[model samples]
Target: MTIASCGSVSATTLGLPNSTAIPAEKARLPKGLFVAKIPVSAKTKQRLANDIESITMLSLLQARNTKLAAGTRVPEILVIGLRLHEPNAAVPTDIVELIAMQRKSGMLFVCVRDADFEGTTRQECAFAVRRALPARAGHTTTSKVFASDWQPAGEATLNATDPAVDSMDALWESLCSQVILDDPSPIDVNTRLARRMQIAQLTAQVDKLTRDHQRAKNPEQRNEIYAKLHKMKRQLEELQGQ
Candidate 1:
């Protein structure tokens, strides 16, 4: 069902302007359907039903309506928040990707959960960005999901700024940079995301090699695993420029 847009509300919680706040109903998705008419696995559909307590579209920024510049392909940006039923539970990455691809919009997802911080239980949120590139042959290619460490809900805001940009595409990049709290480099957002993905792969390889090194009974096997680990670490360091 197409969500009926709620009138303007304050989006200060997400550091967005009040004018952009267009809160919609919590049951934004139909009871048994995928968004944008895309098909999804039953497992994914089930997870959506069980894991998510509510889905709220906090902000909808578009070129024609908002101050943000028009993008060549991307006409709008969606800031969607998913409140989990269990504070510790995680929504699968594939599910997120499916929604982003099907929506065909630049998406900023906020995963809200309750956590104990400073000896008190309070709400916290993590940010994720998955910008889909222009379609090719009716297929959409999405960027690797770039996420930020969890922080107090509504505390962190989009901090990146570019006064010269005139496209929603550039604003999307800035939003990505905002979510990735660790990397503050001046490099382009796409390049930084590529590096992050490579680093993640290298880390996984190194972790497996470490496990192999521990399980190896023979010195030769241990040495081989150690060598592989070193190579992986070197690649990681180069990607990180350290």
Candidate 2:
């Protein structure tokens, strides 16, 4: 059930050299799952290789495909477009097997660089997880596995480049079913006071920009600041969602 784009580009940029499909280890379901679109960079893959195990192997393409069929998926799937990257990235097979044997929770969104280690750990982990689930290929009226999306934003421990979110809107929409767009809800009362303060500031900025656009002296001025205002609005929206 593994899917690659029909287009000619690399999966790293949204296309794959091969349209090969691989099946899962078994058709059984796992206790936990983390379906996410994480951007893994080459540097990040190399650094985290030791932290991972065989359970991260990309042998569960079938289960992953089934997850997609069941209306579940991380926002995006990438391979960093590298041919030499090995599945599991040197993760110990025993550790991988241990993960395979355990029951997991919800899917986690992973963040990775531009398809650098995507083929290595991203796919490997995905395959291992789906493979661990002993489910056979068939439509499920119900499933416990859930999906999430992630983009690396420079976590200090990962030592990787932060992902730029500008071009991932379509991907995000796909992952979270944003096609049925609705007016955002009111602010979450549970949010931290500091975070609420930032949201307030961003709100004020959006209002000011709206005013400036209304009184803009020229089209260029309006357009330039309008983009900035839109950016601020999006950032606020992202934070709110978080």
Candidate 3:
């Protein structure tokens, strides 16, 4: 995959509008018969492959257990190898074609890499991927791809001295949580309306809190009101950002 320079492009350039309303449809990890593709060079291929396999197995097992407990169908996940050229170079046509083919087959594609070809941080690379994702609509898009970095946290340290290592279990847990939350289901009109109603209710609560805060005379009471106001604002942001 081509790793674009961070801050090199704006959302507008990617055809994303600056709107407060979240997209009605979201790109999600498939619940059944999905695919994860990990591409690495031959030098680090075996180690990276092992790590990806372990992570996928752990996540799928956990997801299956949760689904079974909820009386939902247990999902089937498959991990496959995907070879890519050097990171800084354009993505190979074959890899792009493969992604298109997989999406057509109703399979989700996740790209697992340790870092961008230019050595960008994992978090930044994820952000770039997110930015590249097309805006969600009522219909499915041709590309349903996600990416992640698997490097150990200890590689980057504060003060360039004492490093903190994150366990593989922790990374897997985090990735699985993201997959579950980002489920690609489209929200129906009714659901959208319902969400809007909830947002309205929360807005009313915020207004009431603001009024109360203004009336609060004692320092302690004012502090409490401010705290409530802060929490309400955060909830509003989350709902608006959807």
Candidate 4:
């Protein structure tokens, strides 16, 4: 019900009232441009992957070829459909137990019945990432947001899925700007590649945690994981912010 105005024309953020107005809040937690959630099922999980495929561009050239930007329409998720439906609900085993098996592979599955708020008609389907959204975003799924489902949406895929990929490119660019930060000089090609690769490998683990903590179904588990993730992110950014 409360909306914060930051004058940013990019992604519409949904959080507690005034969340956006709080400086640095959005920076720590990435926000999605489009949002939706679907009950989880075997069919729905496959559908969610299909949903992500619809919005993503595999390469830069393909992005331009399709008139899409690298970040546009990318999905950040709140995995739903992985819960125990209370008393004697004789359904397939434990949903969480089933999902946890997939989590062991470090992959998440999610879905949503509504895309662009199409009036809950159940006819139209919107993938995890979409081309449209509520005039104001409410990805948090709280009482004020998506109360009916009450899911926990995380920030994993919002900015960069691979820390190694993102940070290495940034470090490369920083090295190029050798005029400042005393960028150790990239005069040697082999050294540069080796160093960049090392940095990428180190950061990728932390990046994976960020995405995981956000979409976790259990609050206690999510918080424990996120504490570690936040610490790692701060440390990594400080290294990059150098």
Candidate 5:
């Protein structure tokens, strides 16, 4: 197993010589960090969501120094789970756009195979990474892509029914030791905090709208509440998408 040195810490010292180990305290992904799921199909989406949930649950259960959750806010990492039927499957433009947005926010992007599907080729994986994470003109040399074919340990494989959970655990190990690119310029701390505040405010508004819609007794009043609720929901989605 190859281990990359991150900052002043060696991967071996971080307990990541192989992808099966829990990351050291300093090497763990941020607590309460959001991991966005991007899967093209409904089936794949559900699987990916389950995978993320399971990964978080296992990490917490084992007392790992990481706390992750699926969120709509600007994510720290974007997992693109695709099931390719043909060797030449085209990646959708909207997906590319979403990736671009995440990249601009200095988030890491990873492409994985969907549950119960054949894995994508290294070439395909590399292509997705490159497209999603284009290097700046003078910083081309800094752009590096890491690829690994990971298999879960026998215990994890036997205990977990969903393959995605194991895949996520392996991915977490990769992330801990810089197998994936670390954000060079993380989103400003103040900006992120402020955005969270805004989201909270919007969410409260949504809750109020829901209550109003539920209490309306007349059809005309219900129609008015419904329109307002729809607008608020759309705005919330747009903010979360960002």
Candidate 6:
């Protein structure tokens, strides 16, 4: 029954407290559960099985048990650790999404892999934070996963220095910023994530338009594609500026 101090989960162990390791099997979902609940393709299921070595519940963060205040949006946070089978590969997002969708609390995944560096073995870890948006009028709730770049397990640390972390939700936002890197302007995590998604979509659209412009045989078709591409690029620039 040890409580972690504010921002106590270091990058090496990924929120895992020394005294509170849950049974490894408890972290694993039952077979067929993903297939039954989530629309998982056979390929994704196999990929998750092949990439993940083990899953375990490392720690649970709550206001009652920890120093962080209770949040209206997020009452608790679950710290789940995933060990990868392959040192270079990551597990599919399908499994992470499925788990996040089922849980009420915020989900944070810490994935680790062991790789050889200059004839010496070293461990690397990556962090993923889940943001769950409540269901709107006539729409179902959805969750988005934001992941971080892999870091050497021995050195990286979570950034919890923001003074705004007065509640669990704010703390979650701070962690999300660590993984995704917040925008330059002052905006909440949800708004920043939405803008990011929009940027990705616009970038993909511009790429497709560029390819179409290259393939167009008629001058008129090329001109049309150029205009669309220009507009998309402008939109992208605007979003990025914000």
Supply candidate 1's per-residue lDDT for 228: 85
Comparing 1 and 2 on lDDT, the stronger one: 1
TM-score attained by model 2? 0.22
Residue 123 shift from truth in candidate 6, angstroms: 1.4
Could you give the C-alpha RMSD of every candidate to the true structure, in order shown? 5.1, 18.4, 18.2, 20.0, 18.8, 5.0
What TM-score against the true fold does each predicted structure earn?
A: 0.74, 0.22, 0.25, 0.21, 0.25, 0.74
- Which stretches in model 2 have alpha-carbon errors above 4 Å? 1-191
lDDT of candidate 1 over 176-224, digit per residue (tens): 6777635433247656655666788888888889888999999998998
What are the per-residue Cα lDDT tens digits for candidate 5 across 74-159? 23333332333333334333333433443532222322222223654332321123222233367644333333232211111111
Please tell me which predicted candidate would have the highest lDDT against the true structure.
Answer: 6
Residue pairs whose backbone atoms clash in candidate 3: 28-184
Task: Please give the CA lDDT of all the candidate structures.
Answer: 0.66, 0.33, 0.35, 0.31, 0.37, 0.67
Off by over 4 Å in 3: 1-75, 88-143, 149-242
Cα lDDT for residue 110, model 1? 76
Best by TM-score: 6
Q: Whole-model lDDT, candidate 1?
A: 0.66
Evaluation by TM-score, superior candidate among 1 and 4: 1
Better of 1 and 2 by TM-score: 1
lDDT of 3 by residue, 1-242 (tens): 22111122222222222221112132122212223464434534433333322111111222322221221221322222222223332222233233345431122223333345355644211210111223347755443233433322223111101112122222222233233233222223235434655788889999999999999899999999999899989989998897
Clashes of 6: 0
Q: lDDT score of model 2?
A: 0.33
Tens-place lDDT digits, model 6, residues 1-242: 33322122332245333443444445454445546766777877886667766565666667765567888988977777667777666634666776677777777777777777888977777788766653446988776777787777765466444677777777767777777763222137666667777898999999999999999999999999999999999999999998
- Candidates 3 and 5 compared: the better one by lDDT is 5
By lDDT rank, best first, the candidates go: 6, 1, 5, 3, 2, 4
Please identify model 1 stretches exceeding 4 Å from their true place: 1-10, 23-36, 92-94, 131-144, 163-165, 180-187, 207-231
